[model samples]
Target: MAAVIDLNEDVHTLLPLTEHRPIGTLPFAGRYRLIDFPLSAITAADIHSVGLFMPESERSVQDHIRSGAAWNLDLIQGGVFLFPYVATRDYQNDDLRARYYENYTQFLRGSGSKYTVVMGAKNVANVNLNAILNYHKAGDNRITTVYKKLPLDRIRPTDWTLALSEQGTASAIVQAKERHDDQGKNEIPSFMDIYLLATTDLIDLLDDAAQSHVFRRLPELLRDYVLANNANAFEYTGYLARIDSIQRYYDSNLQMLDDASFQSLLLSSVPILTKSKNEVPSFFAKDATVVNSLLGTGTYIEGTVQDSVVFRNVVIHHDALVDHAVVMQGSKISTGSTVKYAILDKGVVIGPNLTIVGKPDKPIVLRKNQTVFRESEVEGSAHA
Candidate 1:
């Protein structure tokens, strides 16, 4: 089977962090990118042929997945193919639909595989695609979609929830907004935007979409197909974080600090892979104190860090304090500065003697390449 990774996610809520990079390339867990989860799942299933559909500006995605060597998708036959949309001011829903249909149809037709697995990059989960594939093969259904039971708050307004029949197949696809009466339910089956279907069936669905002039995203179209055909629903009881907003993103990263969550997601039998980086070991001063934090290589720490994830090459000065924060690569906390409940993007420098703090629910965000010298300057920072 071949695979398709869609990178066109709604990233407006993750601005500044996603302003320059696609959602797929966003740094996660102090090391892996969001795309690594799906790509690693595909690789673990021994699927070498893959296609990535990206938006107009995809330099970050290209830079990270260059030659697809890390995922073993650089083979001469049935290797990785990137289909990026050309930047245009006149782009509309119809144009996007036509473009997707054309590229998706061509990719599936050329993959030379009977089955195709399509997934998006926003939902963070370490799925065992091989097991799902085996289950799909054993069943007689033409389509299978994955879902996880989640709380009401975790379900986004745009997300699709399933109404399963007695046979465990999806009888209807319900939008989160339309389920206001079901708020009392403890948990709802939320779709993961992952689908597996025969190549010919997928092609037929795309052709029907083109003929019907339906302008919808690929995931939405797949949802409609599932409901119409009574697709089989596979329950995924793993740790899932649907990152459609800034609060979810922040919470998801910090959730990794928990031993159980980290072990279940990262230390599982199936490894999550990414582009390798070689750096020197991180240094810590004699008086430095770090507790319950994950630090990347090439870091120099001299301050008190608690409950945080610090990326590579970050520097925390002698008297600074980082509490419950996510510090990206190349960020520096000056000697007298204190950052608490915040996210510092790459190359951010907090000037001396400044204290920037935010509430636990709403973390302050410093965009990429920002240098803040005073408290007033931080007031202008983005707050999730």
Candidate 2:
């Protein structure tokens, strides 16, 4: 078996600490990366040949992936290869076909494999593919995708939501708002934003999708052609969160610190693995006061931090106070400044004595190397 990670350029919606960096390489959970979840899942499933569809812009992703030694994705069967740009060479090079070729070539590289599991990296979860693959083989389905049930009322119209039949088979894909609960049971299945496809069947599907560019997302394209025609789904009831929006990214990180129940949910089974930072333990000065926060290694907290996430190499000055915020690596919180409900990206600096705070609905996002004077709100008021 093999796993494919779509490292598309547009996946930057994950709000990476470094703007130019790819979402998968983005520092996550203080020590791990966003791609760790999916990579770990593939590793645990004993799937060695992992195809990472890296875009040309973010060559750093290719460099960092580094032979997949960190995640044990390096196997004799299939090497973790950074796929080259073939879309431009191919005739049917529209968005849909480009993606098809991208996935197809990656799978083609693993031609001997029986099944291919396509997944997104930004979402933090440990899904047991062994179960899903077993079920798929048992059902004799051409295509199978991992679906998570969603609360209908909570789903928005534009957000992608799945509709399943009485037998729990995915029949129609619809807008979250347009979803009706009255049909048999109010079961709403939302795609985990991940999929599993038969190796031979996926190649055939991609070949067909290349001809017809009606849909962009593979799941939607498959639903229109495969599922709607043949009917199948492998639902996964597991802990998952798509860390797309900035708010969701900040909220999920904070939730990791505060919610034990949520933490247990993910850590309970299918442990997620990541490249070890191998940094020294966090240092807290005598002047530092921290409460209910998760401070990563290599952090030097001399100031006051409350309910926050302080990543590696963060320096909180003696008098600075940070509350309910996520401060990325290599950032400096200067003396006498107070930052609340904000995310300071990598290399960010808060000038001495500045105060920046935003409403809960709209938190502030500061780019890298940007500085805001003490008691000053440098950005995001207009957005707020």
Candidate 3:
């Protein structure tokens, strides 16, 4: 079994949502969180031991991944370990690098595994690390990176790039600049932020990084190491949806409506594991109209829902309409209100006769536990 290192990127893009929890604990797909896929992938690889190094508040993450039983990480021998931020230093400083070095070395030294798989968990993809490990074991490279070749137009500016050599070795790591001014023929290979390496070798790299004062994240540091030394690249051809912004998250959820996309992810050989919830069946009223939407259990739907994802224990009152939106758990859509092209966080309440609307491109997000009041009619003479 390989020792796994799940590191936080210190990415602050997913604001309001991530205000209270780490990126891994952010909710997704109505029933699962962002961390579920990565944990599932880790378990699928049969790697029982993992060290999740969090860079921010980890209470929510801990709560979600409690005992790690769902992913078979509750073994007595080697199980999930939480390594929260312990060093007082800037994320991009030498102290931070040394901090990672300390934790990583400590973890790997006692893991009883020879190989390590390091990755970021925020991205959405059904990665088969078993294949990646096979690729690594078959090659003589010190590090093997997993990357996906996406079209330039489909690629986002924030995505990282990996330029591979003719021998499939990584030659360069490129950070995507601003969007292309011309739509000319320029395709880029986006790095999947996943790597497989020998644990001892990873320790050696950490020591080297500490000595050299390498402050960048592991991916950037690994890029430099790969350039100087021989490292392989594992090309991944699969569905990849990275949820960074609200728009992307909303879009990704909506994209699940497609059979191919939905089937490719959730229907993988290794099922996505999430914390179990004890909830009863959803109740839909006779007048409730739902189309092309996902409804979680214990929900009472008395309104019209279309192209949306509704979570557990939610109440959609009569005469309410939800369209092109995402509603979280314990939220209530009061009667005679319309929520369109918006996202309501957990425990949000839409008051009666309110119409909350947002543009298709920029969806309005109501914070958790918020209550939108009904719009009042202005008493005035008409056509004065």
Candidate 4:
């Protein structure tokens, strides 16, 4: 099976601290990037011929994914191909689904591959395509989409929702403008973003959609094409989070710091991939007190830190107090400064005797490269 990794859309919403950098390149857990998840998934599945679907991100994306060798995607037989958007001669309007179908069709036509599996970089899941491929081969279905169940409250801010049928079959479950009203019942649908399609079937559908100028999403187009046709659903019962916003991103990182059980789920079978940083070990000075925090490599702490994540190269000065916060790379907390429930971006500096605090509902965000004066109220600086 051929795996296609989609890196077209910007995933900056997830990494709010580093808005300048793309989500795929954002520093995750001390060393890895967000794109490492999908790359690791495909590598674990042994899918060598992975086609990266990137349309607009030409400059920065190329530098990051130069050859895909970091994730073992640089293969001899079926390596990775960076596909650019191929616009048709006659264009109607700006249509997202139309662009998706056309771009994928062009990729398939250029490269002669049989089976195709589409994946995105947002979700963090170690999925082995062996089971899904076996299911596809056993049945006569033309398409298969990956889905996982999510809580009702957690389902509000996401794009994909599962709308299951009585027969337990999955129908159209994609990006909805608003939650679809199904009478008085409040049944949510499974979000199906990752799609799998046969080479021939995908070509046919793309051609049809292109000719009709109907730029419907993959789920909607496929649903309409196959009125009574079989579209299988492969349930993924693992740890998965479609990191969408800043809060979710921070929360997901903190979740990885969970004790044995939760951490075991990811490192158990297929390990997640990321760029390796060979840095020195972390050091703690005298009188340093750290509690419930994730301290990365090359960090020096001499103060009290509680319930926080301190990334690489962070420094906590003497007499400083930090709680329930996220400190990015190269951040410094000076002496006598107190920080609570705030997100300090990379290279940020908090001066001595300053008090910066934020609540759980609304986290105080200090912009990148910003500095706070000593003995100043952070609330006033936030407004300024």
Leading candidate by lDDT: 1
**Per-model TM-score versus the true fold:** 0.94, 0.87, 0.91, 0.83
**Which parts of model 2 are misplaced by more than 4 Å?**
9-18, 85-103, 152-154, 182-187, 211-220, 374-377, 381-384
Whole-model alpha-carbon lDDT for candidate 3 = 0.79
After superposing candidate 1 on the true structure, give the runs of residues whose Cα lies further than 4 Å from its correct spot: 86-97, 180-184, 380-384
Q: How many clashes does the backbone of model 2 have?
A: 6
TM-score sort, best first: 1, 3, 2, 4
Query: In candidate 1, how many Å is residue 209 off?
Result: 2.4
CA RMSD for every model? 2.3, 3.4, 4.1, 4.0
Residue-level lDDT of model 4, residues 240-332, one tens digit each, is: 766677776667766666776247546757787665678889889889998888888989999998888789999999999988888888999
Q: Using lDDT as the measure, what is the rank order of every candidate, best first?
A: 1, 3, 2, 4
Candidate 3's residue-wise lDDT over 236-310, tens digit each? 887788777878888888887777888888886768889999889999999999999987899999989999999
> Candidate 1, overall lDDT?
0.86
Tens digit per residue, CA lDDT, model 2, 162-227: 666667666666667676674674456776666677777777776776666453545456656544
Model 2: lDDT to the true structure: 0.72
Clashing pairs in 3: none
Better of 3 and 4 by lDDT: 3
